[model samples]
Target: MYDHASRPGKPSSKEEDAPSPDKPPEPPITRIPSVLPDAETSPAATSANNTTPASGYAVGGGEDGGDNGGANLRRASTVPSPHFALPLWRKSVIIMITSFTALSVAFASTSLFPLTSEIAGDLGTTPVVVQVTNALVLFTMGCSGFVWAPVGRLAGRKQAWIGASVVFLLCTAGTALAPRAAEEKTRLKIFVAMRILSGFEGTFFHVTGQTWLADIFEPTQRGTATGFFLLGTVFGPAFGPCISGIMVTYAAWTSILWLQCAMIGVGLVSSIFFLPEIRRPGDTERRKAATSSVLGILKEFNPSPVFKVMLLPNVILTDLTCGLLSWSQYTLLAAPRHLLNPRFHLTTPLVSGLFYIAPGIGFLLGTVVGGKFSDMTVIKWIRIRGFRLPQDRLNSGMVSFFFVIPASCLIYGWGLQYEVGGLALPIVTAFFYAGGLLMAFASVNTYCAEVLPKSRTEVIASKYFWQYTFSTAGSGTIVPMIDAIGIGPASTIGVAFVLLGGVLTFITAKFGLQMQHWAQRKGVGSP
Candidate 1:
């Protein structure tokens, strides 16, 4: 039987492991615990009771307390207890709003792709220049997590969401209005600047919004909630082109920006009224101690801590695995346009764009099903081990890693290389390839959020930092690799990387608990 009362940092002994005969055995855990009756009060809460003034904040206890000393402190000081439940309908609304917010940001990032010609023609610039603006938006969005994560840590996540949304809205409006400039160079400069500004919005949706979901949902339900949240992200790129293609056909290019602004405005308003604050005043006070001054907050901005998290074996393995997955992901996204257009002898953009819908559907199914599967896997492991470890969730994605992805990539690549079954085979393979990517992604992504629950925001930021860097590299290099080597060989390389990632994930799952214990013992990555 598992001992629920054991606290982290307490020395292990036979007594600690043995269940008491005097008390009856507790029932198996099927639902989240509603109270932390056996847990200690948070350090901040204890301090507040003594000399420090009460900040009127309630803190929640950790789910499992072993070897999570700093995590316990952070969670106990910041997050509310699961007992403070939101109504089911309210939770549903929050999920919908968050998904929509993610969709709006993601839509803007790629919506410009289908409008490149129209935007170029309107601004008196070349199509390549307009494309560069889109690239800049992506690059800026990837790096902005470093800035937003810390701000969310220090001030509050709720404020960060609203502020980023508002800025995104204003930037969309500015981009829409940029065409009115008299000089072509001025118009181009204004448009690019506004796009760069808008890029800051992406991390809020991807990083902070996911963090918010983690805050509200218990471990049992997180997989499904995360899957739902990922829908916005998975479909955005595919839907962006599809929606923009239609909008540009019927309306002006500027109309796309206007629509983005309206969507963002709705998100901003919804967040302000509906989003709950996970970090209360006492939590902010505790955070302030970590960043006591303006200089202290500036010091917190350094990326060293985020990089230091990579020193942990589990975190590095997770990061590298995510990077490899990203390479495969971008490969699929980049291939259709380049390979399909020439092979099919296609001229229309709409027809080529239609190919995206297949992968989009695949990603959606993968995340939703994958997430629920992950939770089930965790429960199964918990029953077998008689206790839970965060890494138990990783096993759920192994099939995707080992078989589903490799087979799909080979089928997609080799099929296209040989033109074996025309468009149907590759298109079908692409769907499974995308499905496998996201199935693996949902597990790894949720694991990242839970791995260091205390420093989740920063940990997630680091994951994105490495993941996007690889994605940028993949996006830039895949076309060249395909040009130099045959599509089959280029994709074979991606499959090999995915295999390596699967091996790493396996190592992490089998030995992660040991590694985490060692790190805690050595005072490395305590949080």
Candidate 2:
């Protein structure tokens, strides 16, 4: 489980290949055929640059020191390369800033939940009407990836990110200043429109962030980086209601939107200053080859594989597992206030929001820990088998699929039904539920990205496209389903989904390699 390498537990080489101390390395070859040359290359030669051999993969370069030679030798021996040198702290900061921005948008998207009652009252509408806004936002955010991904590919990561942030900021500000429903007769419409617009902007951040992280982090350290990113996304929805709950009570519901607007502002500023470009080595050549018209960039970025993956039996089945498992996930956040607020007579938004902490903590810890464990276990599996496959991560997720989601759903639902709605019941159940989700998600996500490394922009765009689409549908339908069926039956339904999801996950883990073969056979992600 451990190694003495400079990076971390993972070894730099599969086998020990020590460099000879006496060798003076060949002069660094700028013309080597690898990915693209560094940006420092003059623009005059940019057009003539051909596809180079893979050179960017080196984790670090050796150092050169004067005089003593031993210190330089040691530094050169230990340090991989300095060509792409970035301190871990800098990488982590970028991850935090980008991830937090993405997550804060996610929170703002759902932050209206704690204020649903107040919003409905002020707007002269029922809770159902307010709830519909939440549903549409999820749907829009999911589908919006198609639009954003192509733009990111064309304009570059930084430009596209700032573009999305600008839209998010504008829409959020509008939502805050929207007129009352009675006075404007169009206030609800305006609010809903703004939320949907924000959702579209929000999806860009997730897609961009996913690809950007993949570009920056090496395979071994990806888990911790991804874990931090997941923390932002997973914790946001859970944390949204709690913070907004306080804001709604102390200030107007508008204050939550205003706060969101400010957050978007921060994200926009960070993106302009800190976000770096992450095009592939030969991406410029590929893009130029693909199209000459500026508008053609959008046209060339097709969604066929994305749709094909969606239609795959295993992929579709995996999505079902994700969707069903998420039933409890979304429902817990959406409908809990109705139960607690009425039964316990807890009317204050802040008090109602306090209920989210149980699931929120569960989600954060589950994702962070699960991601770390996945990284660790994959190494173990590689050691045992004497080879490593990308799908190995999928195998690790099978353990969580069997134990976590179903158990948590049962405990949560039955605990509520038996009139055991104490704090401990939901808290314990939530930990398991959240754990299962992260475990499953980490695997599927890593597998898809790895399998389609060349087509990552499109692949990830497709992944989020479906994931959030399912989330939208779940958020839209969960409350109504709960209303129709009692908590006992509602949870039973969730358990049934979890069971199916578990079975599908098991099948994918077992057959994921074959699926990859199939994808390759079909030329799904060929470079």
Candidate number achieving the greatest TM-score relative to the actual structure: 1
Tell me the tens digit of each residue's lDDT in model 2 across 1-527: 21112233444332344446797544221111111212110011111123232222211111221111111101111222232357788788789888888887788767887677788777667888888888888878877777776666677678878888888889888877665545755887788788788888766787678777766765555666777787888878888988888878788888888788787788788878887776666678866755678567657566565676565445565556656655556777777776667656786888888878877887788777767776776666545533234555666677677777767878887777676867677767866776777776776665555444555555566666666766777777776776787777887877776667778877776655455545544655332
Q: What would the TM-scores of all predictions be? A: 0.82, 0.81
Q: Local distance difference test, per candidate?
A: 0.75, 0.66
Model 2 pairs whose backbones collide: 33-52, 33-53, 34-52, 34-53, 36-281, 60-80, 60-81, 61-80, 61-81, 61-82
Clashes of 1: 0
In angstroms, how far off is 276's CA in candidate 2? 1.3
lDDT at residue 306 of model 2 (Cα atoms) = 63
lDDT of candidate 1 over 389-508, digit per residue (tens): 577789999999999999999998988998899989988998899999999998888888878766777778778777767766776677678989989999899999999999999988
Off by over 4 Å in 2: 1-85, 180-182, 286-291, 294-298, 311-317, 524-527
Q: Model 1 Cα displacement at 457 (Å)?
A: 0.9
- Pick the lDDT winner: 1
